[model samples]
Target: MDLAWVRQHVRQAAAELGFGLVDQTKLVTAASELARNTLVHGGGGQVESTVLQNGLARGLRLTFTDEGPGIPDIERALSDGYTSGGGLGLGLGGARRLVHEFSLDSRPGAGTAVTVICWVAGPPRQRKEMR
Candidate 1:
């Protein structure tokens, strides 16, 4: 949907998953920046969020995809103080720092996709226990 909606949704999801206030704020901030980048630079895209489990850790993963022109220099894009747009240029790098896992894919004329994950350590549980 929109940036605000995305931010709110992400914050709620993080909270529901038992994230602390600081972690929740980090997720919301990251989601907002990426959502804005999708709408403004990517000309609109989709953001998908899901809960994840791996042994004793629980995590939240967010994937953003866009059909607009892809990034030509992913390295530069991820570097601090770099922006094709006239914004503050902390969107990508800052968001990456807020998450446990970060990935980005882009091809000049094709599109761009970004995935980020944040994990919280917990007691180990079986997969069935999650159900």
Candidate 2:
């Protein structure tokens, strides 16, 4: 997967989708982390963006999937400062903090998938009544 393309498309999509300026930055950073994980650890994956309604609220979901050496220990991997190859090890954990919802799936020999959702937080606006 082309990381640059994913980053660019994510930023553009977030803006066009009505995410606030500050929220968009968070989402973009999350996207970058996930993309980097896929490329560096998962041997590359595909990203999908979807628009959905959640209890009258609008949200965006991003799913990243890859077929590569999966996580051996999810709990440890998520623990702060834990790294297999000796690094800062903040990508997955940090990405989770930057969004509304975060989830991960992986198997030792299978692959890994990460899903993140960012909800547009605002008071629900009442729809105009038809005349």
Candidate No. with top lDDT:
1
Tens-digit per-residue lDDT, 1-116, candidate 1: 47779988998788777787898898888888888888888999999999999887889999999999998889888888776676545669988998889999999999899999
User: Which residue pairs clash within candidate 2?
Assistant: none
TM-score of 1: 0.88
Give the per-residue lDDT digits (tens) of candidate 2, residues 39-120. Answer: 8898888899998676656778999999989999998777776655623355678788899999999999899999999887
Candidate 1's C-alpha runs over 4 A off are 86-89, 123-131
lDDT of 1 at 82: 76
Q: What is the C-alpha lDDT of each candidate?
A: 0.85, 0.82
**Residue 94 lDDT in model 2?**
79
